[model samples]
Target: MHPKTSSALRKVDAISKLLIHTQRLLDGPYRSKLSVSTDLESSLSSCKDQLDYLLRKLEVDFTQQPNGKGRRRDKLLRPFKISSHDLKWPFTKTEAEDIIRRLITAQELINRALQVDQINVVLSVEQKANLEKLPVANGAIFNSFEDEGEPECLPGTRTDLLRDLNTWIADPKETRIFWLCGMAGTGKSTISKALARKLS
Candidate 1:
């Protein structure tokens, strides 16, 4: 698995655990007793902050759909007034229900993100294994031969080209195959390896 993705998964897992803890506090027998507990307030605040951070970091745009229908989806959580006192404790039953509802929604989103990441990791591992079974011809395959030095573009070179390739790879609308055609020794392999490393 990619190091960055692993780190993200850990963070998301932590957030999910925090949400669960908070939900249990609200549902437990000591709920009324801990209504004004500083710990409870802090936990709720942390949950809100972490959830917002993850949503932004993941770029999980609630307005967009995979089908390009341009229709907006329901928000993960309703907008709350931006004040520290906005999350006051001693929550009413209705307020507690609303909070639980939002927490469930956030958990659902987190689960979906985890599923997507797991799918990508599995696909990546399977693809690499399949590639390993293929024959290597003069190091034609990327990282196929350990003795042969891997081809990669030199640092500070092909900056514009790399940026364009990255943009094309990111844009869902630009799904066509990008052909990096050049002369035999014109560093096409190098550029390809560099792009692959960047994506990885």
Candidate 2:
């Protein structure tokens, strides 16, 4: 197999695995979180189905190629880019060609629907707004009257504590809890506020 073709196949395998895992998560705890209504589940399921179909189609297309050195192999391994022009269908139409076309559409849908970023899982506009309206830390509200405009952390102070906390965080099998202790006026709350800001 050509090197590029091998690389493309590997990527397809990785993406297929990720899609399957995402599908499972959707079926699991995230089902209610991701859903807009009953239809959101169906849409996510459809995306997973399309991704599976695309992966299979990609495998068949690559395998059917003779030695993976021909135009088909090159086409399959080509890098995707957004172009203003519409893609041209192959002159010689076949069932495989039709499958390939559908695969492209499926891949596009999956990309748009499943692309998650730093903002947790992918959410629709309405979902995002609803989530924002939710109180922080499970409805625990903090009054900002005195706490407003507080510094995220006390700069240049609590260096030792911060270092120890960072070490704890980086420890592979570390316990999940960290206890901070200090005398009454020793700025424990400030340290906590700083730590929360840094962590968040």
Candidate 3:
């Protein structure tokens, strides 16, 4: 009924909501590899208990007081005072804010750690060296086609040819010899290389 009691109850609700949301984040979204550390989880549980106790004390002390203007409410609020000093509501509010801030900071740190771990994937020295090298080869027949850019298939150049070749190769009903007949420089070698790449 009193403003102070209402404010404290609101703060308690906020804190509870924050804790629930944080628990969901830790349990659901970050459940796999980015879970919160066990120590943090324990500390959060303790904070939750402390907040629950404070809320219950506030409810019992304020709501059960006899209807009196001045002395009775102060007397009821005295026994369960939040702090030794005068400020009651601010202390709990500040504490809840601090807890939420710490939880958010911990979440950010865990996300950053996950990003770093993903970036630093394990690779052998040979694999690393292979990644660094240019992905090109210069074999005998392919060397002749070096002038036509790297031996990768040019896009949209040989659709019908590739389809026919694929059909011939996949003809399990009969053994067949495929002949790709085209004049020189009509991209015969290029088609062959592309087909080889597709088959491989």
Candidate 4:
């Protein structure tokens, strides 16, 4: 097997284990527990963190629009919001079940993608051509040959601005366009390039 496929399979296995563990947690005696236990919270937190990491490793972007027979994949990649309080004991059973269902769906999608070969799994040739026609700003991306001399926020500089932008990106409620307006030579382009690199 190719190295990428092997790595993806391992991630899928990890996701499967997490799903099973969560289901068992909900099915076990803890399901009826009312007290908030540190152990339960830790377990839940670890599970969620692992799931997020695994999804990232698999390059599963919930933000991307799925096409063609990707309706199922789209459903599998549906984003969910969870706060720290959600990880506390006496957790919502329905929410836990929903998470398990989503994990299972994601696992299935990954398996199917691996089976069919990864290249162009989500786009057809015509769709690719259409996307190719979209205009992209030259040198707008960080580390491009055209912007090789460009610096990215000088390590630790613009920390607050970067944080705010990331928070805005993660927020589903803030659906408005994020206009990064600033005077020329004030580093607006630098910040944009940094953000683009971070997301990439």
- Top-scoring candidate (lDDT): 3
Q: What digit string (tens of lDDT, one per residue) describes model 3 on residues 19-97?
A: 6765675577544433333235765686577676667666453343345633555665588873223434433667655
For all candidates in order, the CA lDDT equals 0.59, 0.55, 0.60, 0.58
lDDT of 1 by residue, 89-109 (tens): 333447444544566665655
Error of 4 at 173 (Å): 2.0
Write down the TM-score for model 3. Answer: 0.33
CA RMSD, predictions in order: 21.3, 16.4, 15.0, 23.6
Q: Could you tell me how far off, in angstroms, the CA of residue 144 lies in candidate 2 after the best superposition?
A: 4.5
Whichever of 1 and 3 has more lDDT, that candidate is: 3
Q: lDDT per residue, candidate 2, 113-138, as tens digits?
A: 44442133434565689878966763
Give the lDDT of residue 173 in candidate 1. 90
Candidate 2's C-alpha runs over 4 A off are 1-146, 149-153
Residue pairs with clashing backbones, model 4? none
Clashing pairs in 2: none
Q: What is the lDDT of residue 155 in candidate 3?
A: 94
TM-score of 2: 0.30
TM-score of each: 0.34, 0.30, 0.33, 0.34
Q: Who is ahead in TM-score, 1 or 3?
A: 1
Sort all candidates by lDDT, best to worst: 3, 1, 4, 2
Query: Which stretches in model 4 have alpha-carbon errors above 4 Å?
Result: 1-134, 139-142
What residue pairs are clashing in model 3?
none
